[model samples]
Target: MYTVMIVDDEPKLRLGLQTLIPWQELGYEIMGTAANGNEALRVDEEQIPDVILVDIRMPGMDGLQLLQEIRRRGWDTHAIVLSGYADFEYARQALQYGVEGYLLKPVNKEELSALLQKLHQQISADRLEKQVHQDAKSPEWAVYSLLSGSHDLANVSIDNLAKSLGMDWPKYQIVLISFPGLHPEEDERIRSFRERLVTAYAADGQSLVLYFAPYTVLLLANTLVGDFGRADLYRELQMLSGEIRTHMDVAAGETVLALDQITNSFRTARSLLERSFFYDKGRVLTLETPESYRQAPSSSKDTSLLDGEEVSFRLYYLVDVGHAEGIHSLLDEVAAQMAIIGKGETEIRERFFYLANETLRKVSPRLWSESIYPGEPAQFLAGIYSQRFIRDLVGYVTAVMERLARCADYTSRDNEMRRLLDFIERHYYENLRLEMLAGLFNYSSSYLGQLFKSHTGEYFNAYLDRVRIDKAKELLTQGLKVYEVAEKVGYSNVNYFHNKFKKLEGQSPSSYQKKS
Candidate 1:
C-alpha cells in the first residue's frame, strides 16, 4: 500500500483527514501527520510518504513553499494540495508546479478515495518505468551491497568496485555517521550528501560513500599501505566528523583497517557507533569502549530486595489517590537505591521494570503490551531508557510521575492528604514549602494546610518546622553546633531557626547546644 502523510495547521482538520476516509481500502496508509509545512519537511525525511496531503496555508513556509522545497531537493514524493477556496490563481500555480491533485477543504470521502486510487495507479506505473531504467553500476551500490551483507567480499569483485571509484589501495577505513533519534527517510538529499562526501574525498584520491541505515551513512576511504598511520587517518576522520556535524547534527565513529581487512571493518565501525548510546559526550570512537563501562559501578545493594511489592503497592495507591508528591518520593527512593546497586543499563532497567510492571499491572494492565507500550507506560520506560546517566534517569522518572499525578481525578481526597503528610516527612529538609508541595501533590495551599492540620494535628508550616526541628535535634545530639544543625535541616535564617527551636524545644540555640 502507498503511504500518505497529512500536513495541516488545524489539528481538527488533521484528525478528520486521519479518520474520514477508508484509507486502507483505498490502498493508502497514513504514514504520519505534521502541523505545518516546516514540520512536514522533517516528517517527510522520516516517512518519505508516497503522497502528501497538505493544506494551502500554514505558518512558517506554506504548503506551496514546502512543495517547492521538495521539488528543489528532488524528492520523489507526490503532493496533493488542500485549498480552502476555489482560487484559480492557487490552482494554476499548483498545476504549474506539478502537484498531483488539488481538493477543496473539508474533504469529501469519495473524492479523497478516488484521488488516492489514481495516485496508486500512477505510482505503480512509475515504479515499473523506474525499475526498467535503474542502474546498479556505481561504487555506492557496491558499498551498499557489502554493508547490507548481500554480497560478501569473497563472492564479489571488490577490486573492480574499488576501481570504479578510481581507488586501488593497500589500506582502508570506514567512517560512520549515526543519527540516534532521527526518523529514517529515503531522500535524494541524503544520497546527494553522500555523493558530495565522496567527491570531497575523491579530490585527494579514494573514497566510496553509501547509505547504510536510515540514520547512518558510511564512507569507505582507501590509502596506500604505510602512507599514514591509523592514528593519522583517524584524526582526519574526526575532522571530517566535525565538519559533518556543522551541517547536520549526528554522532560519528570510525574504524581503520588494512585493505584486506574490509571483511568486518564496516560492522566494527557500526558497533563502535553504538558506543554513542552509552558515552554520549565524545562522538568520535577509534576503539570499542569496554562493555563494563556500559554499567555504572556495581553495587552489592539489591533493588528488588528493597520491598518491590510494597513499593509497587504504594506507587499504585499514590497514583490512584492522585498523590503526586508521594509517587515522586517513592520513585526517587527506589531509583536512588537502584543506582547504588550499580548503574548498569540492564540492572537499572530491570529494577525499574519490576517496579513499573508491578505498578502498571495494578494501575494499567494494557500498558505492558509491546503493541501499545508507546503510550504512557512505554513513554515512561522510553524516557528512562534514553537517559545516558543515572542522574538524568532520576529526573526523567520524576517528570513522568508528575505527569501521571496531574491526571489524578482525586476520588479519595483524604487519602491523598495523608500521603501529603508522609511526603512532607520525607522532603521537609529540602526547602519544602506549602505552595510548592500543594502544587506537586495536586492540592491548593489552603486545602493542603487544612488537610495537614487534619492529618497531622498541625498547620503545613508548623509540621514542616517540627520535622526540620526534629532532624536538627538529632544533629544536635551528634554534637553539631546549633547554627550548623539549623542549615543542615533546611533553615536559612539563624534568628528564625532560633525562634522555632526555642518554641519547639523550649530553649535557645546556645542553651540547646550546652545541654547536648
Candidate 2:
C-alpha cells in the first residue's frame, strides 16, 4: 500500500483529510499527520511516505518551501498542494516544485478521489515497471521479502527461488551480522566482508547475504552443508563468528534451524542480537548460549541520587529547557540507581512512567499542541511500555523528551541556542573557548557571552566549566587518575583542575571517588 502523510497547520483540516479519504479502498494508508513543516520533516525522517498532501501556507515553513527542502534532501516523495483561490500564484510556484496535484481549500470529495486514484495508478505502474526491470531470482531480494513481511510462501514458490540460487539443502540457518553505528557509505565494505565469510563457510554457494537495516546484514546459510553434520556446522559457525567479532568488530547472532523454521529463527536471532546493546559492539551469541544471557537486561547502578528532591527538580527544569544531555545524564543516574536497588522490570517501568509523565506535563503543549489536557496521561504512557531493558527505557524516554524539546525550542533563535548548547555538551572535553564559538557562529565574543548569560543565567566560561567538571567526575568515578582526568576534561594544569573540582564539588577527585 502507498503511504500518505498530511502536512498542514490546521488541525481541523488534518482531521478532515484523515477521515474523508477512503484511503484503504484506494490502496493507500494514512501514515500520519503533522501540524507544521518542521514536525512533518521530523515525522518523515521516521517514516518516509510515498505522497505528502501539504498546505500552501503554514507557520514556520510554507508548503512550497517544505517541498523544496524535501527535494533537496532527495526524498522520493510526490507532493499534492492544498491551495486557496488567492493562492493561485503560490500553487503555480508549487507546480515548479514538482507538485503532482492541487486541491482547493475546502476540498471537494469527488476531485480528491480522482486525484488519489490517479496517484495510486501511477504508483502501481511505477512499482510494476521496477519489478519487471529487476531480477527477482536474487537471494537478497527473496530474503528481504521474507523479513519485510511482503512474502507469502504458501502462494509463492520459495523452492524455486532457492533452486535459482543453486541451494539444495534440507536445512537452513539465519546468521545476523551487525556493525554498530555503521553508516550508508560503509555497506560495500560490509558486503565485501560478508563475501569473504560466505567463501570461508559455504564453498558450494549455499549461503546468501541480505542487506537488512543499516549496520546489519543477514546470511542465509545452509546448515546441512559439507560431509560434517549439524554439530560440526555449529562449531564452524561459532568459529567464524569469533573471527567476525575479532577482525571485523561486528556483533554476530545466529540460529541454526530448518528452512521452514526461518521466520522463528530470525526472530530468535534478533532477540539475541538485542544483547549487543549491553555488551560492547563485538559481542557474539548463538542458540547454544544460556537463555538467561539472552533475556532482557537488569542494571546494578545506584539509585540513591534519584531519590533526592534536587535531582527531580533539575530533571523537570532540564526537560522544560530542552536540555537533551542533561536529561540523558539524569536518566543514566536513575538507571544506575535502579540497577543497585535490583528493581525488576515492573518497578523500573513505574519509576520511568512517573518521570516521563512529569516531563510530559511540562512540555505536552509543545508536542501535542492544544490537544493535550488533564486526565490524559494514557496517551503519553503508550510509548513507554514497550521498553524491555533499562537502556531501552532510557532511549524511549530520551527520544520523547528530545521530540518535545525540539518543539519547545522551535523558534528560530531558540533552536540556534539549543544547537549551541548541544555542541557544548558534546564537545565539553575539548579545548572549547568563548572566542572559538564566537568566531564559529559569527558573533563577537562579548555579545555571544551576553547571549549565553542571558539565556542560562551563567557566564559562558562558567557553564563550560560546569560541563567539564561533570565529565571529570564521571571519569574519576571510572578510576582515571587526577592528571588523566584533568587532561581528559581540557584542563592542562592538574592544580587548576584540583582547584576547580574543589570549588564546585567541595572535594578532591580522589575524595569524591572514594565517597561514591
Candidate 3:
C-alpha cells in the first residue's frame, strides 16, 4: 500500500482534511500528520511517503518551499497542493514543482477523491512500467544467473553472459549487504535498499543490483578487491543503515577473473554474511573471516566443548541461589565454550535455544513475574532462531539469567529472615542486636524488627531475653551455679541476669533450679 503524509500548520484544517477523504479506500494510508514544514521534513526523514498533501501557506516554511527542499534531497514525492486562495503565483510555483493536484482550501470530497484515484493509477503504472522494462540483457539478470551457479549452467558461461552485457572487466567481485533483526517489514526495506543502491550507482556503470532474499547483491566491475574498492560504498551504506537504525553487515568476496568464479564469489560473500554473528557487526567481513570460521579440520570441528544440557543445568542452579555474578560468569564461559565447540551455526543456535528454554523454565512462579520475563518457550526458541549474531544472543541469555536472578533475590526475603532467626537460636549466648543482623542481611533495623515479630510472634529483644532465661533455667537445674549460668546465658551481669530470670521464670535462678 502507498503511504501519504499531510503537512499543514492549522490543526483544524489538518483534522478536516483527514475526515474529508477515505484514504485507504483510494489505495493510500495516511502515515502521519505534521503541523509545519520542519516537522514534515522530520517525518519524511523517518519514512518518506509516496504522496504529500501540503498547504501552500504555512508558518516557518510554505508548501512550495517544502517541495523544493524535498526535490533538492532527490525525493520525487508526489504532491497535492491545498491553498485558501488560488493565487496565480502560488499555482505557477506549485506547477514548477510538479504538483499533481492544486485544490482550493475547504476542499470538496469528490474533487480530492478523484485526484487521489488518478495519482494511484499513475503510481501503479509507473511501478508496472519499471518492472516490465527491466532489460533481460542487463548485467543484473546475468549476475543473478551466474550467482545461481549450478550444473544447469553447463550451457551458460560467464564469457557469453559478460559479452551480452558488454562487460570486459578482468576483475569482478560480489558484495552482499544484509540487515539483521529487521522483522516483518524487512521485505519493504529490502526493496528500499535496492532502490537506494540503484539510484546511487546508476551513473558509475551498469547498476548490477539484485535481491537474493535477505542479501542484496551488487557486482562491482573492474574494481579492486577488498577494502580498496569498498571504502566509498561502505560509507554510503553505513549512512543508509543509520537512517533505519539497524545494524548492517557487508561481505565482499575475493577478486575473481573467470566468469565461473562468479558463483564462488557469491558463495564466499554469502557465507561471510551468514557467519557474521561469530564476528562483530558494523565492519566489512571479507575472504579471511569466512575461511577461518568455515569449519576446522576433523580434530577441531568434531571436538565438543559446550555440553548444552550441562550449561543449562549450571544456569538453573545459579538462578536457584540468586547468584547474578555467577550467572554472568558462567554465560561468559558458555560463550567461550561455544566458540571452541566448532558446531555449525544452525546447530549452535538450536543448542543454545534449548539451553535457554531449559534455564528459563526453572524460574519458579515466585521468581517469574510476567512483566519482566514475557517471552514464552516458543517465543524464546524463535527469537534465538532469528537472532542475527552470537553477541546479541549472548546478551539476550545474560539478561534472562540476571533478571530472573534479581527476581529470586527479591523473593528470597522471607528465607533470609528465617535463616537469621535460626542464627539467633544457635548463638543465644553471643551479644546480638536487630540492627547488626539487619545490616549483615541487607535490611533496615526497623524493618527487620517488624519482620522478626511477624515471623516469631514476639519482638527481637524480647525473644532473645526469653531464649536466654529458658536456657538459664536448664543450666541451673543441671547444678550449674547461678552466676555461672547467668554468664553462660549471655548476661555478664549476674544481678541483672538474676532479675531477668526471675521476671521470665516467675522466681530467682535458685528457686527455679530447686523446682526442676
Candidate 4:
C-alpha cells in the first residue's frame, strides 16, 4: 500500500482531512501530519512517504518551501498542493515542482477522490516502467535470451542497439557457463529453470540476456549501465551454480567477456567446461584472471615423443575418444616440450591456449572464430615458425600414437593367451587347472602358461588366485561369511583358499574380512 503525509497548519483542517477521506479504500495510509514545513521535513527525513498533501500558505516555511526541500533531497514523493488563495502563481509553481495536483481551499470530497485516483494511475504506470527496465537488465534474462537465440532475433548489434535504443554505448560483458554430466533431459530441465529465472528478473525490471546450448549457458550483461551491480551478478551466478548442483549433483564453470567480446568468452568457457574431466564440476570459473585457466599437464603427452600434425591429431583424437593413456601421454610430451623451450608455467599455458584455440579455429571455424589469428597472416606464420607449433603439435600427434599403441598392444597378444584370460575372467568361479584352460583354448599347458604370463605379467595360477581373492573380498564386504565367500569364489577347499589368500594378500581371508 502507498503512504501519504498531510501538512496543514490548522489542526481542525488536518484532523478533518485525515478522517474525512477513506484513505484505505483509496490504497493509501495517512502515516502522519505536520503543522508546518519544518515539521513535515523532519517527518519525511524520519520516514519517507509516497505522497505529501501540503497546504500552500502557512506562517513559516510553507508548503512551497517544503516541496523545494523535498525535491532537493531527491525524494520521489508525489505532491498534492492545497491552498486557500485563488492564485494562479501558486498553482504554476506547484506544477513546476511536479506536483500531482492542485486543490483549492475547502477541498470537496469528490474533488479529492478524483485527484487520488489519478495519482494512483500515475503510480501504477511509473512502477510498470521501472519493472520493464529492471527486467531488461537482469542477468537471468540475459542468459535466457542468449540460450533461446533471441539475441539474434533482436538484431542486437552493439552499434545498432546503442543508436536505436538511445542507450549510451557501454562495455558489455558475456560469461559462458557450462555444466558437464547433464543428460539430455536434465539439460532441458536446466533450460526451463533458466527461463523461469529470466522471467523473475524481468518482472523486477532487470535486463539479463541468457543463451542456452548443449552442456552450457551464456550470460550477457551490460557492464557500462551499472544497471545491475557486478557484485550482485557474481552472487546470482553463484546461486545459479548452487541450484543446479542440488539437482544434477554437479558444479558448473563460468567464463566472462567484455562487450562485443562474446566469441572469446565462449572459447574460455568451453575450455574450462572441458576441464571438468580432470577437475571437480559445478563451480563458477571466471576467465578474466590468469588463475582460472590453470590445469595440470595432460597425461597423454607423458608417454610419447611424436611431432608435427601427427602429435596434434593424436592428442585431439585421444581427448575426443576419451582414451586415458593417449591423453596422458600427449600432456606429458607437451609439458616436456614447454620445459625445453625454457617457458615458465604461465608462458606454457599461453602457448597451449593459443595452439588449442588456433587448432579449433581451423577445424571448427564456426565455433572458434578468426580471433585466434591476432595479427597479419605473414606475421602469424613467422611467429609460429620461430616459436614452433611443432612441440605443441606433438602433444596432439602423440595422443593418437598412444591410441594406436593401445590397439597394437591388444592385437599383438597371442590368441591362446587372450582366450585363456577371457575364460578366467568369465568363469573364475568354476575354474579348472591350467591343463583344462590349455585344452579348452587348443594350446599346450606349458605354452599357454608362458603365453599368459607374458601377456598378463603374471603366472596363470597367480592370475586365477588374484581373481578369486578379489571376488571373495567383494562378497565379504557384502557381509558374506568366510566360508560363504570361499564357496562363492568356487573354492570348495576353504583351508586352501585361506592359505592362498594369506599368501597373496598378506592376510587370511578371515582377517581381511575383519579389517574390511
Top-down lDDT ranking: 3, 2, 1, 4
**Residue-level lDDT tens digits of model 4 in 72-91:** 99988999999999899999
> Which scores higher on TM-score, 3 or 4?
3
Question: Which regions in candidate 2 have their CA more than 4 angstroms from the true location?
Answer: 1-133, 155-164, 185-203, 220-256, 287-516
**TM-scores of the models, in the order given:** 0.39, 0.35, 0.46, 0.30
**Residue 247 lDDT (model 3):** 73
Best by TM-score: 3
**Deviation of model 1 at 164, angstroms:** 5.6
What candidate 4 gets wrong by more than 4 Å, as runs, is 44-46, 139-516
Alpha-carbon shift of residue 291 in model 2 (angstroms): 9.4
Model 1: CA > 4 A from native: 1-135, 151-164, 181-196, 199-202, 220-263, 271-276, 285-287, 290-391, 398-516
- Looking at candidate 3, what is the lDDT of residue 74? 78
Query: What ranking of all candidate models by TM-score puts the best one first?
Result: 3, 1, 2, 4
Q: Which is superior by TM-score, 1 or 4?
A: 1
lDDT of 1 by residue, 1-516 (tens): 778889999999999888898887677789889988888887636568889998888889888888888888888888999989899888888776789989997788899788887787778657633442363555555555555555556855667657665655655666666444432233334445555656666556666555555444545454323324544544554455443443222332343444435646666666655534334333344454333234433442434436776566556656544566666556655666654455555676566666666666665442234223246576676666666544455556666555555465444566766666666565567666677566556678898788778877888778788889888888888888777987898988888899999999888867876777
Candidate 2: tens digits of C-alpha lDDT, residues 315-375: 5655544555556656766766655555556776777788777766655464546323333
Best by lDDT: 3
- Model 1 RMSD to the real structure? 18.4
What residue pairs clash in candidate 3, if any at all? none
